[model samples]
Target: MIVSKVSKYNTLNDFLKSKTFMKIALSMTGCKNNRYELDQILRWAIKNKVPVVEESEADFAIINTCTVTSIADRKSRQLVRRTRNNNSGLKTIVFGCAARAQKKVFEEITEVDVLLGSMQEVITYLESNISDMKKCDDASLITSGEAFTRSRALVQIQDGCDNYCSYCIIASARGKSKNRPQKEIINEINKHVANGFNEVVLTGINIGAYGASLTTRPDENKFAELLEAIFEQTGIKKVRAGSLGPEFFNEKWYKVMQNPRFSRHLHLSIQSGSDSVLKRMRRNYTAGQVTDVIKKLRGISPDIAITADIIVGFPGETEAEFKETVQFVKKNRLAKTHIFPYSERQNTLAAKMEQVPVKLRRERVKKLQEVADICRSEFIKSQLGKKAEVLWEHSRLSGRAEGVTENYIRVRVMGARTAGSITSEVLTTENIDTLL
Candidate 1:
């Protein structure tokens, strides 16, 4: 069923409790924010003793969809069909951006039992259908610890986006910006700290615009204020920020970066480094503004990792414009760069513009990726012989552990180590694999 509006359920827990046990299979494709939401559902299932099973054995399937690109839409559809084929009797619930963006597409799918547009709708549906439901005793389950399988916890401080970038459909899919109260955010972080989670990632659709919609705060830099509050209120060892816009860097933000608790890595959402392309895309910041922010951040900590997301082959992007993006990425010496070849989204302004040829887009992606690889390798090499704080996540090989460093570098260490422990290590070439 297509969700037109959220029903009367007030809290997520109202839908979480059930008298009878059910097996669920969860699948998702999206950003970290979507992943965090999925994790919440997983945690709820765990707390209530619901069995999360494989697709073939599940009675119900929850599919969190993504519509960031045309391919994402295809994958989401494929997932629904595959799950149904795996078990014809399995009921499917489709939610998230893809279902929200193209409700008709999922409605056309005969296998989908529920098509929810938002988290509220998902909660309401569960509350109505699940019999003998009750509220969870531990309210802390709403925000605190992650799934038992995870080493780090993700706390979403905000949701939705207001920026109508020409190339992005997220605004239409996610709706307007909404900020979670600072008190709730602090409480969540404190809970994670007490749960032995060494790191907590602050995630959102447009995290840089965190406090723009809040009425209680008159401060222009509410995100900086939030960071200060977390630093002062919570004992979490490290706080990592999700993708942010260049405009987020200001004097207040710079001051907060000086705090040792803040992770020394920043992932700026720089869609295009070419000023002309950025103007056409309707991005708020220019190339110069991004450059200035990166310089300032590097100045604060010389070895700080600077990463970015670069969209190659935007509509009408000339060869010169693409070259400018290449030069910008190379000059910044970015620790890592997520490269995407622009894909047309229905109802987005960029879709109506002069389109870049598919072959040309692929070529540009390959060329830019080469530059990104070199930059990543150089950044990794720079960290060699330096001390890094790593939070071990898992171990694939016996007597060895793999983890991510504070600066977002992946490293594997020899000998026995616990998955949840944080330890300082001197990075050497032998310990760092995937150096490329």
Candidate 2:
């Protein structure tokens, strides 16, 4: 099941044009996974006007997928085959979390000529010399510098994870926590700034843990210092960081946030608000610590859009624990809550603990959704009258245009669409689409 051999210096642009005007198509599913990965590839496609044909019309389709859930895995498989059936002779590439999670069987798909994991490698493979693309499980190793779509590129400050959370298989699949050198990060940020990207988000498997293993215990290269250097040295106007953990919070982080250009967005992963559940899930922080951080962020910048990831229904989650989670959100008044039902990933701590019936998991998720809706309603109410910068995106509403507020809220405005332009601000609390 060996796919085509990718050459040593594969770049996505070079790969796409290697075949002479191939209509490349790509799609992504899931939360930040969607925004960070596919957004980069598609943005590249749009910028180059590289004949990135839509799913139905594509000659060579790429699926940058997810494996967060068994259901998500199903969707990835379905999409892979669907693309194959639709374009019978067309070449398809299936990579990303699901592809890795499901074994190297994707190379079995006769129609899919190439499968690369992680967005970082996928981009390189696309532009890489057609012969250099290696069909290996290590997507990151397929390294080649890409121009990205913009000058302000996401310099992956880190990659992989060490925490090994109970329900997540990311650590095993992606491997250990790996951080690019501080100087390397600064250089990339400088490159992005020089290219014209005013903002760069420090990204990785567990970004908040940056500098921990790199420096000695007493004189560490702190995450905060990394931020300071990125700002003071690189002069990148906006700095956003995450998949952060609550344990990483310290006053030094407060010092970094004092900078106005540091985006007031904190994406905290709160699997559940119940303490017993947190212990069972092996999450290091309690609900209170998470709240304290949220409150601190609000005090520092009230407009900060605080987002969270919550997984409901572990092995033996009871109604009381579920209620506690609901009450936790009610008290925290979270700006946004990403709700997920627990999925039993193979070879994880949770899968072996005990099984929560599928029906029960669904019910728990439904209840949490109810609570999340309540929290979102309260947060939106708080956002009533604020001026926020929004990045405009094309719309499905009328094939027109829309934009996203800094806190990640979508605000539909009256204007023509431009792909990457940051447009004017509206002095309204809620966006037009909210009412619709």
Compared to the true structure, candidate 2 yields what TM-score?
0.80
Q: Where does candidate 1 stray beyond 4 Å?
A: 1-20, 133-145, 214-219
Top TM-score: which candidate number? 1
Give the 10-residue window scoring lowest on summed lDDT in candidate 1: 4-13
Give candidates' CA RMSD values in order. Answer: 4.8, 6.6
Per-model lDDT: 0.81, 0.68
Model 2 accuracy (lDDT, Cα): 0.68
Residues 1-436 of candidate 2 have per-residue lDDT tens digits of 2244454124334545555444567666544534556656765655444555566656578886677788887787778788778877566676777777675666555545677766767767665433443233333322223333332345566666666778888777667667678898888678666655656666666777777773112123378888888778887777777667777878898878888878777888778889899988877779888888888888898878777888877888888988899888888877778888788888898898877788988887887778778777766666667677765555545655676665667777554755445655763653634310
Error of 1 at 337 (Å): 1.2
Q: How much lDDT does candidate 1 score?
A: 0.81
Of candidate 2, the 10-residue stretch with the lowest lDDT total is 136-145
